[model samples]
Target: MVSLQIVKQSNAGIASLPHGLVVLFIGATSGIGQSALQSFARHAPSPRIYTVARPSTFASHESLLASLRQSNPTATYKLVEADVSLVSEVDKAVNRIIEEETKIDILFMSAGFMALEGRKDTSEGLDPSMSTRYYSRLRAVQLLLPLLNKAPSPRIVSVLAGGLEGPLNEQDLDLRDPNNWSSWNSSVQATTMATLMLEKIARENPRLSIVHWYPGPVDTPGLAKIQKFGMSFPNPMSQEEAGERAVFFTTSDRYAVQEGLLPVPAGLEVAKKSGGGIFLLNPQGESTDNEAVLDEMRRRGVDEVVWNFSQKVFTACNVQARESKDEL
Candidate 1:
């Protein structure tokens, strides 16, 4: 877990991106996304914030927007009503952002939640949770790569587990494992896959600092989503602790100020010093460079295997990364 001091320092500082920076946020309507926006606005000096969410969520989102505007009148908040879980919608949204902006400094994705119901796939043939949590997040990152690359210190913060990776269910990378296919399994699979994939992307595009973080827990409207599926995380303490950890992660200042409210803390700082790789971050806004895990992966030599499988997934999705020309 990231320490309280790191989060406090991050939250307390008045920071701004290198001037002329743009940001794109997915899942901005609730949970970590909204909290990240507020925290980013707390210290950011006039940032252009674009968020994608659904219409029903937009109403509540609007209220949050009002509060943010009230906090920082200079901030520009653009709410894009779109179901980010859909690859097509993500494609359209990325294209829209690219149509206007020359570059995007940060692509922050926090648009995911757990489902209690058995695996549900979207019209895109993606499992519901996986669609929103993993594929959608990756799609946004992939779609916005060029724009992000344009920035001097381009970064992508995807709110999933980065450090807590597991064996690449080579057989069921999609978690179709008939033996166990519940939300618990899905979360683990998604987290592990996301962690490895982020590493792969970092290696492929060293210029882009990719960090996947597990935002301990935040008290958001979306928090109750898991129960709707009629299932639990199976680990009540972890869930409870995650919620508690979320508070510090969002409010902390050390990583927040350094990373600049990109969402979930990042390994940007850590990766910068150690070379490009996924920064497995915890709630208090610190990176976990679990050398053990990295060594193990290196020993197993699954990086290529995981990367190849992910590329197949991304390829099958048929999405192209685009740069944003929009200023806001």
Candidate 2:
């Protein structure tokens, strides 16, 4: 486990790194993503930050951004109004970014929720929980790959279950059947598919650095929403600490394939990437090993299956979107 002191010390160097780093945050309206955004705004040297918020949250999110502007007057903050629960909206959001920015230095995503009640599908005919956690996130990455490759040390940090991968129902990839779908099963499927698909992207784009982190029980508005479900943990990590660690993960060279942003600390060596080139991290920000589950998935070419299925979903979303426009 990387100690909190080390995380903070590493994050402290954000101000020294080159200025005007391009960063985009999805689901930053609240919770871990919001905390990380605040931390970055406080420390980064003139970062060009872009965030997405649904229409319902835009006003409140703007208030939050106003505070961040006060904290760091040099940073440029742009909020794209879009709901990430649909791939079509994600495509629109990334298109706006692509038109404006030449490159993206960091892409931080923590937009998702565990639907305790049941699976709720979006207008695009996708489960909102799955769409937020998997489909939209991957859609954003796919659309932003060109810009990310242009950056010096591009990093993608996804806040979700990383080390915890379990048996995948290869037969039912999306868990479409009611008999196969459950909140726990959906979460596992999302995380497992994410690791596999992300690893594929890493191999294809060797220079890119990807970190899938499982932040065990963070104290945030998101968690508070689910508190009535009778869930409890011994001690939840403070949001501030999680934010600091997130900044370190985004900027530190220890997590990179090539040193470009912050330099590696004196005693630490660059982190070892998983066999597939992605970093599966635990809550403590340490590299986690989950080959037992991943190796089989890869050997069976399940990664490709997941990718192809995801592409089909994206294509369906586009078709539905176009149909809606034509009807209108």
Candidate 3:
């Protein structure tokens, strides 16, 4: 049996943030991303936070901002209105930040979705979920590399399953085969890419700390969607098969599902309270690196390959990565 380490809240592994930390959060609208946002503001020394999201969706998030302001009245919040899942939009957003700010200490890339269908390619002709989950997030890192390097104790955290990586369909990197592609398949692919790329980027930019987190099952709104749409992969137990599946998460069955709406405090609290390692924040506070896989990524030129391909993806999309225009 694999020994699973469980960290309790009382563990001494949590670390506090420094003052005047300039952090950028993508996918801060909901789920684990939102959790981290709320938690960071609550714990970090007053920070200048810029979150990238769509303008149409901004009004819906006012209540969240209100609560966050309540927790940390001094928190400086800026909503960079854009669709970060697109390379063009990501480039524009980062450019805007660079134009304004001198440096950004932290870049949190957690924008992704658990799509329940086969590949839905974007206008850029890239797989939508994959683009959002891996490509778009990677683009943010590439564009912000210079700014991240300029900061002290620079860190890039991508919240996805790194340790739980599975087989990569190298032959079909895009996973376009309708027969083979599924949401779970896409997730597995995204997870694989994130694991390989994080190690790759960490190696190339040795000065910057790269962390890809696997926040173990927290009952967030996303979980409800996963339950609703049914997993892309083989789900062993549907609610029909087992009441536990339906019974456990069935409390919110009353609300209308209009294809939108979405956190909880756990993720933010975890991000606020983490310290060492390329942190994969478990339910509790501690983190541990998967040395075996990381070592392999180093041995293989996977990082370079991934980065090259990623840049090619952005290049093919004709996205211009411009710095932000805001004053520091």
Candidate 4:
């Protein structure tokens, strides 16, 4: 386990890196994403940060950004309004960023939730929970790839169940069938599919460092909601702790494919990558191997299957979005 002390120590070096680093944050309105945003703003040297928030949360997130501005006067923060549970909305958000920025150095995504109340499909015909966790997140990455590739060392940190990927329900990738669509099953499918799709992207963009992190249990509003469901974990990591570690993962070369971020901490070697060439990280910042399941999926061409399915969904979303605009 990479100790919290080491994590903080590495994050402290963020100010030393070149100024005006461009970062995009999806789902930074609350929870782990919010915490990580605050940490990055506090430590980084004049970073130009863009964060996405829904209309309902925009005012509150503006308040958060206001406080961050006071704390880090040099950093620039822009909040784009969009409901990230919809892929079409994600497209709008990404387009807004693309219009202004030439390159993105870091793309930090932690926008997701557990569908404890069961599936609620959006107008786009996808469960909002799964859409937030998987589809929209993937869409943002897909749209931002060109900008990411332009950076000298680009990194993407997705906070989800990285090492705990399980067998996918190949027959029903989206768990559209009610009988197969338990909350747990949806979570598993989202987690597993995210890992597969991200690995494919990592391989195609070798210069990009992608880290899929499972933060175990962190004390946040999300966890509080889970507690009300009569489910809980003991001694969950503090939000501040998780945020610091997340910043470490974002900036430290310990998890980087190329050396552009902070140098790897002493006594720590670069973390190992999965067969598909992305970091599957556990809570403690250690690399995890889930090859038993992942290898078989790759061998069976499941990665390609996922990629093709996702592309179709994205295309459909784009068509629908354009049609809506025309009607408007």
Candidate 5:
């Protein structure tokens, strides 16, 4: 476990790194994403930060950004309005970023939730929870690959279940059948599919350091919601600590594919990558080996299956959005 002290000490070095580091954050309105964004904005030197938020959360997020700017006057924050649960919306958000930035050094994604209320499909025929967790997140990465590749050392940090991959319902990757669908199953499918897809992306873009982190249980608004369902974890990590660790994962060389960001902290070695390449990290910043399930999936070419399926979903979403627009 990388101690909290080490995480904070590493993060303090961010100010020394090159200034104006361009970062794009998806789902930074609340919880871990919000905390991580605050941490990054506080330390990074003259950072250029872009965050996405749905209409409902824009005002509040703006207020958050206002305080961040006050804390670090050198940083610039732009909040793009878009509901990330929709792939089309994600494209629109990314396009906005692409229009202004030449390259993105870091793409931090933590926009997701547990569908404790059950499946509620969006207009594009996707469960909002699954879409936010897997489909939209992957779509954003696919669209931003060109920009990411241009960076000296690009990194993608996905805050979700990385080490906790489980059996996937391959027959129903989307879990369309009601009988096969449940909150638990949906979460599993999202987590498993995310790992597979990220592995594929990592292999294709070897320079990009992708960290899929399972931050265990964090005490946040999301966790509070879960508690309402009579489920709670004992001694959940504080959001501030989680945020510091997240920044460590984002900037510390310990998780990097190449040396560019903050150097690995003393007494620590570079974290190990999965069989297919990206870092599957546990909360303590240690690499996890879930090859018992991942290796077989890779051997069976399940990653490709996931990649292809994801593309079709993106295509379908675009078509649906276009048709809907034409109707008006």
Candidate 6:
């Protein structure tokens, strides 16, 4: 386990990074995303930070940004209002960024929730939980790839289950069948599919450093809401601790494909890359091997299957969104 002390010590060097690093964050309205945003604002030197929030949360989020501005007067924070559970809104959010920025150095995504009440489908006919966790996140990545590639050292940090990938329900990739759909099944499906798709993207974009992290049992409002359903952890990491670790993941060269970000932490060598050339990290900040399952999936060509299905979903969502606009 990479101790928290080492994590902080490594992150202390964020002060040394060049100014004007552009970063875009989704799902920072609350929970881990919010904490990570705060850490980035506090540490990185004069970073141009963009964070998204839904209409209802925009006012309060702006207030939070105001506080961040007071602490880091050199940083620029832009708030984009969008309900990220829908791919259409994600597209708009990305387009707005593309219009202003030439390149994006970091893309940080942690937008998702556990639907303890069961599946709630968005107007685009996708379960909001899966859409938020998988589809919308991937949509943002797909749209932002061009800008990401333009950066000297691009990094994408996705906070979700990284090492705990499980067997995919190949027969029903989206869990559309009522018989196969459950809260647990959807969460598993989202995490597994996300890892596979991200690995495929890594192969295609060798310069990009992608880290999938599993932050075990964080103390946040999201957790408080779900705890009534019998979910409990004996010792959950504090939000501030997780935020600091997240900053390390975001900026440390230890997690990068090539040495570009801040130097690898003093006593740490670069992390071992997965077969797909991405980082699958455990809660302790150590690299994990899930090749027993991932290798089998890749051999079966499930990655291609996932890519095709995702394209179809995006097409359908685009059509629906356009139709809604026409009606308006």
Candidate number of the best TM-score: 5
lDDT of 1 by residue, 16-133 (tens): 3444457787876766666666667655677787888776787888888888888887778787878877666777778888888888877777777776657777755567788788
User: Where's the lowest-lDDT run of ten residues in candidate 3?
Assistant: 247-256
Would you give me the overall lDDT of model 3?
Answer: 0.61
For residues 67-157, write the lDDT of model 5, one tens digit per residue.
9999999999999999999999999989989999999999999999999998989999999999999999999999999999999999999
The stretch of ten residues in a row with the least summed lDDT in candidate 5 is 302-311
Which wins on TM-score, candidate 1 or candidate 6?
Answer: 6
TM-score of each: 0.77, 0.98, 0.74, 0.98, 0.99, 0.98
Which residue pairs clash within candidate 6? none
Q: What is the lDDT of residue 179 in candidate 2?
A: 96
Better lDDT candidate (1, 5): 5
Residue 16 of model 2 has an lDDT of 92
Candidate 3 has a TM-score of 0.74
lDDT winner, 1 or 6: 6
- Give residue 58's error in model 4 in angstroms: 0.6
Error of 4 at 186 (Å): 0.7
In order, candidate lDDTs are: 0.64, 0.91, 0.61, 0.92, 0.94, 0.91
- Judged by lDDT relative to the true structure, which candidate is superior, 2 or 5? 5
Predicted structure with the largest lDDT when compared to the true one? 5
* lDDT per residue (tens digit) for residues 154-221 in model 6: 99999989988899998998899999999889999999999998999999999999999999999988
Higher lDDT: candidate 3 or 5?
Answer: 5
Q: What's the lDDT for candidate 4?
A: 0.92
Which prediction has more favorable lDDT, 1 or 4?
4
**Model 5 ranges with Cα > 4 A deviation:** none
